[model samples]
Target chain A: MVEERMNTDKMWITMGPQHPFSHGLWTLRVHADGEIITDAEPEIGYLHRGWEKECENRTYAKIIPMADRLCYSASMTWSHVFCKVAEEALDIEVPERAQYLRVIADEICRIQSHLMWLAAVGTDLGNLTVFLWALREREFFLDLNIRLCGQRLTTNYPRIGGVRNDMPYYFERDCMRCVERFETVGLPEIMKLATDSSPFVGRMQGIKYLTAKDVANWGVTGPAMRGCGVDYDVRRDDPYDAYGEIDFEVPVLNKNNPKGGDAYDRFLVRLEEMYQSCEIIRQAFQKLQSIPKEAPSRVKVPRCIPAGTHMAKIEDPRGESIMYLVSDGTEKPWRLKVRSPIFVNVSSSKHMVDGVRIADVPAIMAMIDMCLGETDR
Target chain B: MTEEMIQAPSYEDVNKLISEKFGEKVVFRTSTKKNVKAINEKRRIFLSTDRDTILELCTYIHDVLNFEQATSVCAVDYIDRVQIVYHLTNYFTGIVIEITVDLPADDLHIPSVALIWEGANWHERETYELFGVIFDGHPKLERLLTPQSYEFFPFRKSYKLRGSE
Candidate 1:
């Protein structure tokens, strides 16, 4: 009876288009042996809104607002990248003040984006306190977003040549306050709840491992790639906007640790990145002070772009976001392609989660920081 | 525990090596826009090659040239012909070498580079589904985002978008 009851065959378990751990609408079909996941396949595109194809219909300027919708959490960077590409196609330079403003806005987006990811990771690991604390800090950054731009989540602030508007009254004061508080008090308190907790570390440490070679081969970028020991940050290496002038350390997990590139290493990379973003914001604010307040922030550009192909890339909070623009000397674009980091990163999920326990799937995948709006777009 | 990373090839070195290898078959052009402030615009490199030897050319780019990442794989429908564009990047230098393969509209078949670098797998698949450019030798060439039953390649210039004449 005992021999007859034992089963030898492995089972296929389907995770979600609607599962709680997904954080978005995507399905993961995993081949399992009791508890260990042998193989995994991810099915995305549930949030597909034809983002690339739609850009072809609209004129160059109209797409900036649409780009903001790509990722709600990092809306500033999305719009900034679109503007960067259009700026390249037009072959124009952003003003000195605008470059600093873009950098400040980008770091703001990065901090809040990582905070949102932290909140998601908290709930994924079944910790309510971390969820609440991370979200509370994120609220202040979102409020900063409203102070600079008119919108909270979808900020259509970046224009083709520069930004939408100059800094509002006392915007720098408010931004500096928020960044300081988050760096000193807000981040440390949240860290005590999550990073200092043994249970939180226990759930994440040594779970889903991807070597540096595997990361490079799969085209993973941002914190996920840095977590795996690849010291490539577009902000530092490529240096679009004001990043070339600003000085900050990019945290990589492989520096001190021999066994890095696990879920926990990725976690540490993001946490350290939040701290670095604070430093960047502080520096950008100082640089802005050097420039006159009357200095131009927005440049007037033409409606039509020249007939040529141009590309621009920016270090998004998630990864390296690139845009390719093909123009036909018309008001509208001939072809526009968005190289979303999450799209390529999500494709490598199979190699990431393989051989990990089924219960640890959420923790491993949460390191990816899935934002379906960008992924599906 | 520190692994040795490959040093990225400079733009001059990359251009020289490709010109030597492919000779007259490859057309090399450096982007020169007058009075541009962005670094990427002045530094961008473009290489035009035919679809016949893209696999071989890309293999050399990947294996010999040490381009670690296929940054993007996208297709453009140019009415009479289709252009399959692959942007490969060397991380150490932050340089992107864009390779464009011109395919006749009648035959949109090109050899897949997914086997060379697994990162190009989904990019090729997405290109295949949206533009109907069949990437021959792709492991799984199924529709990624669109409905499987839909027979139209929505990104094709011939297939008109809704509310547009």
Candidate 2:
């Protein structure tokens, strides 16, 4: 007797929407051949809240909170980007001292953001110890953030033309202390735990390789592009804030390093980047200290922005975050468009995860360091 | 090449080239603010070139005028017409070129420049999906970022959330 064969074409596996490691409300429908991902489709909009449409309806000042929700982890970056674009649209000049303070806040946010990325990436790689250590270091910066802005994550601390609040009395000392601690104890421990682990290195070293050409072609930026041998950093290339006046190196892979463009290179690059961010914060703190104790934190501008379009790009921890603001001489902006780095970075996932095993999917996605909130927004 | 051999083309030279080549097909031209002092002479030429002449203009901009990267594509709806703006930037020299096309609101169609720059593929798909502008001869002209079954174009000015429209 011949037995009828059951259908065994393509197996659909649900990955997220409730998974512990998943960043936000996103689901992955994977078509696999044993362990190989033949086709992968991302099902998004589960977390979508019509933020763009909401921005159009709300006043410019009211949109700040919504901007914070764009990338919850790097909330300051979103607020900074929004304020900068609004300032440009309004043609308002930020004070030199205010710019320096903005840099301090921006760098602190970067440190915290990279720490969060490191922790999340570590957690994804099964190195729970690294996650705890990284988060511990991250909390240092978050504490500083809370002290300054009265909130931990969504600190709507930036406003058009300047910051919402002046630097607190303990700002300089606190930032310097954080930097000293990061250099002396925090970063080294993270390096030892993450880089020295055999399984972590083996899991990340040569996996999901993206070339410099691919990086440019896909418009991938930040650490992911830098991981693949691209020397472009928006901070260095397109200077904003006091980044132009400051002295900090844009860390890329050493030319002599054999495995220059891979997951290992990216890990090393971010490791070095944390150090660079520390140096920037220290310099900014010193600058802040040297400035007069009483300087106006906010700039005076007309209520309505000049009738035109303006675009501003800033180097967020994730990548080059761009804000395009269109104002028609109204209290509210005519249009506000955000070119989020994660949106561009995540678009290259199909190219990155083609031949990799199913087990490697999480690691690859983490390397891209996508924030679905930003992407969907 | 010597410094004289690589003489930087003035903004007028670039503007003159577009006018001389495209003539009547060109619609508008304007200059915008740029960052660098060295490229102060640079101008952001906003041209509404013909759909058939897009590849030719893109090639001319790349090979001759030397705009290296296709920076961004912005789609705007103006009630009766949909305007698609291609913001192109010269990588080596920081010159921005804004190429625009206005299609009627009823049947918004333009030729796809995916053949010229592969980066235009996704941007075009996004524009098509959001503004209902069809790119003729696109490889995979389907909805991206938005779900396939999404009935209305969200970016359109007429598109309301639930009850407003």
Candidate 3:
């Protein structure tokens, strides 16, 4: 009976399109032998709305609002990238005030997006306290979003040449306070519960590890790539907007560590990134104070873009998000292609969970911070 | 070449290397936009090559030039011909090279670079399904966004969206 049991063939186990850990409509079919997974395949595109084709119909200005819908958690960066590409096509420059404003808004979005991911990781690991605390902290950042832009999630704030508007009266004070509170109070509390907890660390410490070589080969970006000791960030390496002037550390896990690119390392990298985001916001506010209050934030741009193919890349909360715009000297774009980071990162799921056990799949995959909106689009 | 040049070659050096290797077969275009800011943005290179030489060109870029990542592989339909663009980036020098290959309407097949960089696998698949540009050796050239059985290439100029004429 023992010999027969050992000789059983591998079976394929399907997870999601609706599973809780998936956090979106995508399936992961795992080829497993009892508990250990031999291979994995990710199937996405449930949220595909033909986003690229849709852009071809709309004018340049109208596309900014639609870009916000690409990712629910980090909507600001999506719209910023769209506007940046349009600005590139037009060969225009953003005003100084708008550049600083975009930087602050983007860092806030990064912190909040990472918090959202932390909350998802909590659910995957059977911890409700982390989920609740992370979401509660994320609320403060979303409140900042509402104050900057009228809406909360899909911020139609970034315009073609600049931002929609300047920071409202005393908006900087409130933003600074929120960042400080989160840094001092909100972060410590979450760290105490999650990172400081032995059981939580034990669950994530050594599972689903990847090497630096594997990460580079598979085109993983953002914190996931940083976790594997790849010291590249689009904001720092390929600077855009006001990011070139700002100084901040890109946290990367040391490859020498045995648990270097595991779920825990990725978790640590994102958490540290939140702290860095707070620092970036603080510096951006300092720079904003020097610029004249009445400086023009948004510039007037032509309705039609000249015939050109331009690309703009930004450091999104999840990864390096890029927009490739091909204009045929018309009001409407000829073609607009989005190179979403999650879409590429998710392709390497098989390598991510190759030798991991079945029960560890969710925790391992959670490090990706999967956002299907951008992926499917 | 100096040690620093070998490790992280400047854009000019890489351009020289490619130009020397491929000569007149590849046409180079540099895109530089005027910016009002004090610190100007870097210029990006766009190299247009025939589809026949893209595979070999990619191998040199990966092995010799050390462009470790294929940031994107996308196809644009020109109504007359299809253009496939591959954006490859070198992490060390932060240089991005945009390679474009035009395939005539009748011949939409181009060799795949997914084997050279595994990250490009899905990108090629998406381009195949949407633009109907066949990547000759793509490991899995299946539908990425649309249903597998969907016959139309929605991104092509011929296949119109509902609201667009």
Candidate 4:
């Protein structure tokens, strides 16, 4: 048997604006001293569509549809944040039932988004089975979204004061079924695949660690923060929509993170969060059943919200998503700013990928759940 | 037995503490009600200050007030002046504090908070290109969203392009 040794040659390597391992159209340029990464600089903006500037030109109603494309996998959450901001800015009220419906839509969106993330993680680690299974499971929720809003990925369901559409006729039954399958069957399988024996675990177990202090400094949030053993979640901390009325535990690094934070811990945090999303959806579904059949789902928004400045934040599946709006005394906005969580998350990569194996970079980046649509916006 | 409940310091209490401590350095402190109701932000306080006191104030915001991170930095052009906002939050206490400072269009420069908040690096760069608010002392202030060679303040109202009036 011949044993090969690592050759410590220094060179710069660029991992795509078009590499399979790269999340989106972002390039990660690495300084590789042999197989170890000495330094890395992440380059983004391949997906920048100037959605914020476009929002400046369009009326508030027009912007909701545009925001749906901001994070296509989790469109409801982005649209919901805008709706709340507009509602608050306009001083409009969303009825109790409408709020509850928004909660249901948002949670369903959360599960689907996380499943897509799970698939991406699996693909990054070269596990095609998990990727296939995760996406297969995601279809149930995607189909449900279509039934409710007439669109799947970019539903554009959330309007200014409330949701645009009501729950479909059999949505109650369909949601319960999807929730049961994802919780009981789909999640357990993913866990087995992730936690069970695989050579990939050695690559992910103790690599690309981010300390709690580093996470706080970089404003990292969502599963990445939870995986680092700092248990803070915006849903519980800053309750929006029907979150105040719901009950769910924010999952953290329940595992012994001797590495402070690891790719596997992020994997576990996301897996556990899926179960919690199921719990929230179940509770919201029960509350949703009691609403009157003919209750109005959306209110009439004025062409322009009263001239004011307001900032709204929500716990996106990725992290803390913020939309700050300043309305002039006109139909169009004076200014609109979107603080993309992934942009900040990706910025921390120049530090994270430092001193890591060049091989481990893909797995490390995957754990952060990079979606360039929002980051580049 | 009923428990003697402990409550975190109220927003007004924090506001008063800030007022007494910072005094006139604060250009204004927003009322606790509107600030709190802004997304049910229980621990956040909004304050505006001038550029001269910004670096000193951000040091106070970081070292004294214990803001863990600056989540976002953006500049809004009001035609007359560009008002930049830094949204800082403390994770442990679940408190968010928004710091605002204005720069006139004629002199659009403010001391960088990037020195305090590492996450402000890309944000400051983006704001520089888009709104032309130079973050003085920012180690590498270049175009983030736009190309490196590009030099237009696209987010500013004055930079009108070919398409629209």
- What TM-score, over all chains together, does every model reach? 0.97, 0.88, 0.97, 0.94
- What is the C-alpha lDDT profile of model 3 across B1-165, one tens digit per residue? 222225466778888999998999888985666762211444366799998899989988888888889999999889889989999988876778899998999889999999999999999999988988889988888898899889989889998788888
Kindly report the docking quality category of candidate 1: medium
Between candidates 2 and 4, name the one with more favorable TM-score: 4
Model 2 stretches with alpha carbons more than 4 Å out: A1-14, A254-260, B1-50, B59-71, B89-97, B114-120, B161-165
What DockQ, on C-alphas, does every prediction get?
A: 0.65, 0.26, 0.61, 0.45
Indicate whether candidate 3 or candidate 4 has the larger TM-score.
3
lDDT of 1 by residue, A190-281 (tens): 88778788988899987877788778889998899999888889888777878889999998878434454899899989999999999999
lDDT of 4: 0.81
When just chain B is superposed on the true chain B, each candidate scores a TM-score of 0.90, 0.81, 0.90, 0.82
**CA lDDT of each candidate?**
0.88, 0.75, 0.89, 0.81
Model 4, span A136-221: residue lDDT tens: 99999999998999888999888887777788788889889889988888889878987784776776887867777677788777
Candidate 3 lDDT, A110-180, residue by residue in tens: 99889999999998887889999999999999999999997879989999988998988889889999999
Query: How would you encode candidate 4's per-residue C-alpha lDDT over B13-123 as one tens digit per residue?
Result: 557766886789885555422422543455557789889988877776666556777889999999998899988876656677787888888999888888788888999
Off by over 4 Å in 1: A1-3, A255-260, B1-6, B35-43
Worst 10 residues of 4 chain A by lDDT: A1-10
- Give fnat of each prediction, in order: 0.67, 0.06, 0.69, 0.47
Where model 3 places Cα greater than 4 Å from the true spot, the runs are A3-7, A255-260, B1-5, B36-43
